[model samples]
Target: MSVLDQKQTHKYSMKPESAPVFKNLSSDLPSGLVVFLVALPLCLGISLASGAPLLAGIIAGVVGGLVVSVLSGSQLSVSGPAAGLTVIVLNGIAKVETFQAFQLAVVLAGILQLVLGFLKAGIIGHYFPSGVIKGMLAAIGLTLILKQIPHFLGADKDFFGEMEFFQFDGRNTFSEMAYAFQHIEKGALIIGVLSLLLIMGWDNPRLKRFAFFKFVPSALIAVLVALGLNYFFKLNLPALTVGQEHLVQLPQMDTWQKLVNQLSLPDWRALQNPDVYILAVTIAIIASLETLLSVEAVDRIDPLKRVTPTNRELKAQGVGNFISGMLGGLPMTAVIVRSSANINAGGKTKASAFTHGVLLLFSVLFLSPFLNQIPLSALAAILLVVGFKLTKPSLYLNQFKLGWEQFIPFFVTVVAILFTDLLVGISIGLAIGVFFILKANYKTPYFFHTEKHKQGEVIRLQLSENVTFLNKASILLTLHHLPDNTEVIVDGSKSTFIDYDVLDAIQSFKVNAKERNIRVHLQDIPEVISTNAH
Candidate 1:
């Protein structure tokens, strides 16, 4: 092996994963800050998209970070309100008639997830094809880039966290861009461009050589810089002043008594309605799938290469969602965007995730006024950077070079997700993948070989070790094509098991062969006699 390769392998093998979670406070602190900055806007925006109270999203974030992180087996995964669940949450609320009623569904969903975890249903996530998973990641990245463009351009018509192709405002993905171009705000535009540049520069290896810049969280720096710029422009550069609409809109809670009034209770009466149960099942399935997928993705990026227990993660999510629901929060799941930000900022343990949640809670309680000053454009710029990294040209090329069998499903997944919702897109990719698998197995289910004998041609049909119903059609076709008056020996000595349908077909063919004057001999293959004659 090359020296560099050996060195890298050694370094990776030496990672101290057994250390206490709080051991790396320096790394966790900065990482928690980055995650907090990324998560704050997403929590608010997802609530806006779901037609739920804005505070509900924040409660989910707090529960996800504080509660889920504590119970979860994953060290690096961060959880919160997910863009993938936005449509479902909206439709569920509409069906249940009230936001409080939807909370009941969320609570039931948590119970369902807990049951699933105990049943060990998390193994389903591991079965996802590698190509499809990569496709999912790429799709999310591209979607983020496309959705964030309007925010980056200072167009505040559509809110943040709209990752789907179709928006709530009657416009599709492309139309949002067209709208942004026409109504772009100059001040927001300037800050977006500069923030993008700074974020990109921070990631560059050449610029990161400076030790001073290495310790600072790039996304946090970007937000603070953008906030300062907007404030400065309003005082001095009048033409470049950004309007309040283009900035974040955290709810203003000025006093402690007001915070208590904001707390909401779930409608237990909704559970008596049957529709709530259906919604509960739907939420449980989708949330578990998203969590498993995120767990898989986060493991792929971990520096220490620690494996997470999927069942434990589901249990953790179940607990968090239950608490959040009881407290009037939206459904929660392990979100990819904030998790990626946490990893990129050098998070070492679950402490970073939990700390980020604490920061989120503290920020809303005490720093809402300051957070409101942060521009949406700056946050968009940070998301754009993450989006670009995920959908890099290298990722596309790698998938393409894996051949059409892999590429077709992978490419199909990306296109479907762009046009449809997350679950629908993933289902399409899985269907195409299964088609390829069945096609390969349909043709070669038996070993057929012929040799010339002294009297006549001797044919041997050797059944595979575990031939089943899938091989029935191929065996029937081969037997029918055989020349009349030929000597044939059907062998199944090596087979551990054979389907009854295949055995019956061979036995029926033997009777037909006798009339044609063909010599048919059966070896260890089973014979079936019909009992339906009674």
Candidate 2:
């Protein structure tokens, strides 16, 4: 069939059935432990950075893990407090007059997300081009690498999970890295470097043969070893001890009563306040966006290539935010960092995410002291590996080989995200991707052919099945540049729809053809009053 005659066909693939949560216990358990280890400090760090109580982050993490995981159809995506919303949460608290008021906003945001889910607003995510999605993934990978370098060097100037180019500390990503390099703590650096090396080496096939390496995740092992080394440093190498400042700092809530006392409730009276409603709308929009983007990215990296129902994901996040706010927690989203960690750690089912949540609650209640002993450097090291996996050198070479149509956007996205933030970078990349789409459409909407006849040459122009305003310019150019003393046939027999502007151009051209001794013949094409007549 000719290109224009070909009908579009979609190949439907059946989604793989998800293994039962407990069926994959061997792999899921260890994967959950790794995610828990990575999430602990982050929950604390993001909460501290957001100007909220430390318990707020923990509460959100728990809700994301326990509640969202159960309600969500996505087997692999892990949700938690997102760093992207820190600035919003910080400013929101100030505007609302109290943290309690902000909690009210968060609760309302969840209601809005639930509404959006029911309205099927999640379909908006499907409109993003594949090039832009790949660009986003690559950009996130690069950001992780650059941002984690300081933590790897033992300079904890920036909070964990901060992804923006410009930081709250008055230093940009690069400047902060420079500052960290200049003031490296020997003790933290020792733990950081060694921890990174250990995790990297722990993945060898030779090591996997042993049950020790098979059942235990490298991230947990690295943390335990770092803790032991830090202790040894405190005793033998006093100067090299990893200090308290560089360790995981969970709020000391030793008793159930103390934990309950720290839990702050949202002020229902704040619902009547205009500012509270405004913040709620803002949180709902931004949180839903981040969640959509993160889940889309997660699906791309999933080994099974399972497609999560986007509408269902929105509902799950809505429920998570509502419960978290009710319990005085920070706003949450499907965090790429934690979700990617879970996938890389071999988590096979939703059980892994649930296990991580259980671990978070357990650690908060009974293991706070031991959890605190784990070094930030160790977590940083694990993230570094995750970062490297995301932005591997092979990925760049592959994109480059796909031609400029793909490479330009991918390259631009990586650069834009590195210098700006996630949402902004993705927007820029989307614009570029759309430009290419339009460019391609401009050239491909019709087929043009030339034939030699006994009396004279003939020009045949065949319109595609559908033509829109975007194809107007191309049609106009072809008609205006026709050669004199030629027989031209403009055919639209197969065209299902044609734009008015295009029809007008064709009608106008027919009227003017006689002036150049050009004979115009139209077949199954509509005739309308020429725009030039008036």
Candidate 3:
């Protein structure tokens, strides 16, 4: 199918009115399992990237699924240690001497988010331009694909979730790809190729209709198949065998005492250090932006067309992050990948989200042994697909067709992220977007569309709905350059608030009209007493 057709299909699936069985446990259970399967690899990979303890990602996943889901107003969106914040987390960790101190930062960030939620800062999410948001989404998608390539090839030194141009090693993104080719392990390459092929086949339209396939996530099936192959055939084809180094590794803890010993402790002393507060504010703002964006995307795919309460979602995320940090988890956000999987899997309600969390908790507590055997190559393959879905060509084409006003910022963001980090790229995109906003405003404070009348030329100046001091230059420029003996009508009928600067300019021009032979008429405009009147 064409991209347009695929988009239409998604839109059709999301019309919430069509699906009335939101409480169907049968559907939600299976769907939640699928989301859990997807979240596992992502959580681990992101934690790896953040330089946090391996268990920290799992902690974020559990809290996201269990704590945040319950508190969130979003019935469908899922939360976890997102790739978008991986770089920020790593940088924050660097700023503080220990991971424990970073956890303290996460706690502070959560508190900030709570304050923002109460302040109703969620409305600000709506103010972000659509072009910038799409740019961000696309940039993240491309970053995922680029960062996962080395992992897929079993070059596991670099973090699978790193979005920056530079790697943990000194190499940049393309340089890492070159190194991966030179150091490719035969066994890993075979597994990666096969697993990727499996993903492609699983995406086939004809095969998904089977009842069994309908219940099982394609990613889970592919991972299981890869694991079975590695476990059974590792001895025979050494070249194709996935080593323990290339498989999932979880710390073995048989009892509650052992697990408690493994958990890291946050340094309360770090709270008194003012530097921690700076990191806290940064994490809170960036994490909130990422979460709000994911919520926006997930709401689009929601079967019920339900609108998520952004403020409530922020509060829920705040609570979750605070708890996660207390327990030594990395920062968290509403991640679009797992959320999309949940929606696509026919997840019915928040139960699917809650269930996914329970499943993560269960896996860490009881099933880590089995999970540790899954090859990293398999997860990398799955992420490759997830990445492709986000930066699809169709999304680019759609934006390009919208004109340069949208496409320029979108393309710039993608390029910026490719060369820099997520936060930096997004900042560049926002800066460019703001420039466009100002550019439009520079021309729009007042209407300058002139018309010819029987008596020479007539100029009608209609002030915009909200004219601020920014409009002063344009208004004055028009007034100062008016032709002699021209009739000018200044209309403020549609404006609710006109700045004093603008009113003063108009009143000054009215007084100067006597010398210039200009005829001036004001409509619903307030007069400013000008010194020129004296």
Q: Which candidate is the best by TM-score?
A: 2
TM-scores, each model vs. reference: 0.87, 0.89, 0.86
Residue lDDT tens for model 1, 424-506: 88899889887766665555543444444444577888777887777777788777778877888988788878777777788
Tens-place lDDT digits, model 3, residues 1-534: 435334433443435423543546677788788788778877887888788898899899999998998778777889989887887888888888789999999999999999998887876666667787777777777877877777788776765456678767899988998887777776666677788898688767788778666666676777788888886667677667777777777666667677677677789999888879999999899999888877876776577777677777788899998999999999999987788778766787877888999988788778889988887777778767777877899999999999998999889988887898766887898789888877765665444344544445778877778877777877787677777888889888887887777677788888889798888888877544223322
Residue 336 shift from truth in candidate 2, angstroms? 1.1
Identify the runs in model 3 with alpha carbons over 4 angstroms from their true place: 1-28, 91-96, 300-305, 341-348, 444-450, 453-458, 464-481, 499-501, 504-515, 526-534
Q: Could you arrange the candidates by TM-score from highest to lowest?
A: 2, 1, 3
lDDT of each: 0.83, 0.85, 0.79
Candidate 1 — what's its lDDT?
A: 0.83
lDDT of 2 at 148: 86
Alpha-carbon runs more than 4 Å astray in model 1: 1-20, 254-257, 303-305, 444-534
**Winning candidate number (lDDT):** 2
lDDT of 2 by residue, 113-170 (tens): 9998888787777778777778787788788888888887788567887899999889
